[model samples]
Target: MARENGLQKSLFALLAEAHPEAIVTLQYQYRMNKDIMTISNTLIYDNKLKCASKSVAQRQLDLPHFQQALDSIHGGASCTKQSCWIEQILDPSRKVVFLDTDKMSATEERIMETVVNKAEASIVLQLAEALLLAGVPEERLAVISVYRSQLRLISQSLRGRPGVEIATIDKYQGRDKECVLVSLVRSNETGKTGELLRDWRRINVAFTRAKSKIIIIGSSTTLSTTALFGIFLELMRTNNWIYQLHLGAENEHTIQPPPSPREKRNREHKTHSPAEAILKNRPILRDVYNSSSL
Candidate 1:
């Protein structure tokens, strides 16, 4: 049957290859918000993908419900100094978020043949619970991971809520959710992202599965060692979408959001000379300028 359709290729791929002129690529995606679609559009589709409509492109999660949920969870303090990072990532306005775990002790461990990161699992669980508390239906949320062991750990923790899908990234192809929480559980000192993440198709699928918001939890220092993820990190940094997870006393944790574009621009205007502003705006030139004596 596989050979009859096309050996090692999907039937659609085979048809598209045979009838190149007849093939029509879909340019407008209705599943993800424009911000959520940026990664896949820039990396996989060469910026060809666009939002189907302004409403779809600008849609965000329910902010009032999210704030209420945070208040209930944090005892009426929705945006405390320690937990402000949570609000920033969960803020209905933010469609794409990267929760960088580089500063935390989120190392991955090999369980016999499979790999799992307990820290990643715990953070995912917390986020899921908070979303559920925020009035997001279980069916509208999903937790995805590339590692089977990591999925298993998250599944076991979230077993009581079976409606919230917790599965491997490959299982989530052609499926989407209102909110998608991704756990990239491969933190280490040597910066190994594993063979699974090297496949751009998987990354594209994982990133483009959310309708309103997509929150990725991972170690930037480790994942940035790779070419694709290095580009992704730079994109996130440039857009000020990366938030660092800081672990405090008594197992307490905090995440601080990067400055907004306006704030960054204002700071630069005040602190930098004209030449410095030019270098600051162009990071590549800034690196070169720093390395040179002049």
Candidate 2:
């Protein structure tokens, strides 16, 4: 008999109920590396689901060694694996990190009745370009966000860059990538960031897609309001996987809250020189830029 619904509501149960022996569980996950797997595993730990058989490869590749060898070929001697501005996330050893950013200005745009955070697109483009320069093949990288408008902003910069996919999180649900950069576009002091926080399943899928590295860019203060993200942030702190970009000398809290009358006047009077403008948008080399620069 043909069912009206093309998708079964309980396919797994039906399969198990009909023929217990027909279910063959595939436990081996060849997609994500151990570091990415750890993050994914922690998220699902309480679900009590028997998933991702423990036999997944611990090391996907000798990332540090490879980078060193590449640098040597390029006339740079004794290169470290974490050489770029992405030291917090990209490593040959463990490739997972959380980067906290002061919310850059966002222009609110609506698409399909959903609001999109357009501010994050610039940061996302900077990150993708940095990764490309760091020897991650354009073919194996993806930049995913929850909003189509954000993707559109990124697509403008990444246009004609072959093999690099910029898409919404839903498009990436079943897809895998060697490196995945996620733009968590909402960062506000009031904790009014929308469905992105509430959609944990999409977030899970985004985290699990990376085989080698996962770089999550968002505001720590905003994310800390959510339980899942809070735990993840704490874990990153405990493991030293959290990194922050120092946008300016002023406290970051100033970026999140709406400008008061005095602050608005200060901003209106403030002017950035050409060098400062360049520095703000340019990708930084972590090893080169010391804490003083931050």
Candidate 3:
């Protein structure tokens, strides 16, 4: 299948099902509270919801290139998720959903066969920064996935973000959103979203919560190989459909490619790694091999 407008507009919206199927022997809660929804294709679902600022006010800012790009709803050519500006989500309409899409891959199964060590734990910084930037009301937003235990610390990171709630996908089973931002954290060849389940139904539950927009941010390679991306790509390949394809783009939200060996040593010595950073800062070390010798 091709990779284009992978998720159609209609495919992004949702309604209550009359005959909901019951497969797992589990019980959960569904909010009948004054359910809130955001315009511009926001959704509420059992698992995730996301939002991007498409406000008229946001559009008119005489900002730099980065800000202008962010203001564009589909700025695929240069869309980014900056740690600083994510606070804009607090404007009462959109909420954020951080996803982890690496379920039963070889990577998941073979982690420290002898040591029951923790998953890389520092990304909590990303989650914390997301909370601040999105400006989402904690009471109105949440965190969900199978990695609840690993992400529990993320809640601590949000103490100032209005005490956001957290849950597993099974728990998200009936709620909906106004604007949804479903993040898929997939570093795997298989795009399972880090859960044993990645069927269209699961994808459906995650996608069909919006009345206006649904934006998925995940491992870009997954789109080329996974069924979820394949389905949408297939649909787009045949039509004039186009959705912004952003992964590790330039401006913001770009993953600083993991440190190479030399870069790692420089960081350990508290020295600048780049020529510009080093020249301007002027660290007194000449040889990274021996910091004291230098």
Candidate 4:
């Protein structure tokens, strides 16, 4: 099982490379707006296997209604005529948002044998409830995270609610919905990411799961320290897809770390049994074991 856990060795990976023509890319995306598509494109642009509809013309694009809705919501004359009408209509403050929290608050906890970010979970719950109030169909919305604990926490909050799926990134793969809200739960003084950072495939799966819109709630400051996330946040900034609750606080700052070996030290230690302790206490038995070992 351990040997077969590799992505490259997976059946899907083999099939993808073996028969490229057999794979079909869905060009016409009714799920996400052009802006969301653009952001997603930037994230996976460097991928070896490219999307067939790289050009807008080939993709059969449709006009996003958020701009029209915004005009109606606040009258046409209020907003300046800009190229990014979708953002103007939806408002970055609501559509694509970042909720920052302290390192202490963002700490992970083991619940039901799963690691969950309680701070992030709480924020997602608030957002989900708000979205529900905004008349978003419960069936059309999903809450995704990289940790099972977070999923467990979110699932509990939305319990008995129909059509709302809460899952981890791996579980969300190959699934699409109208809206997805991702909770990137890692936060600390050091810009340390867990196993999730190294798994770009899972990250890609999580980001691309949404059809209409995605609201990402996370610690931008901590995330920007990593290469992949730094690029993701940069694209958000460049595209004006960022919605901030706090003003004049620069959250996305890049500190370029010199390239070196990226090594991760395991923080978890294995537990020893009482029988193991008793064996160690007996020096004569331990010595005989050592002598036979040679």
Residue 100, model 4: Cα distance from true site in angstroms? 3.9
Instruction: Give candidate 3's whole-model lDDT.
Output: 0.37
lDDT of 4 by residue, 4-32 (tens): 66644568778989999899755455445
lDDT of 3 by residue, 1-294 (tens): 222555422322322233345323222222111222221122224333332333421221111233333443233324334433332432233222222222312122233422110222223334333433334333544544334553454444444444444554555667654334444444455544433235455555555443323333344345447654555544433432333322222233432223445556677777545654554535544445347545
Relative to the true structure, how large is the alpha-carbon lDDT of every model?
0.80, 0.65, 0.37, 0.60
Q: Which candidate is the best by lDDT?
A: 1
Better of 2 and 3 by TM-score: 2
Model 4 stretches with alpha carbons more than 4 Å out: 1-8, 16-28, 46-94, 102-105, 110-113, 245-294
Error of 3 at 44 (Å): 16
Report, for all candidates in order, the number of backbone clashes: 0, 1, 37, 3
What's the lDDT for candidate 1? Answer: 0.80
List of clashing residue pairs for candidate 1: none
> For model 1, where is the 10-residue window of minimal lDDT?
248-257
User: How close is every model to the real structure, measured as TM-score?
Assistant: 0.77, 0.63, 0.38, 0.61
**Native RMSD of candidate 3 (Å):** 15.3
Tens digits of per-residue lDDT, candidate 1, 121-181, equal 8788777877787788889999998988899898876766768998889999999999999
**Rank by lDDT (best first):** 1, 2, 4, 3
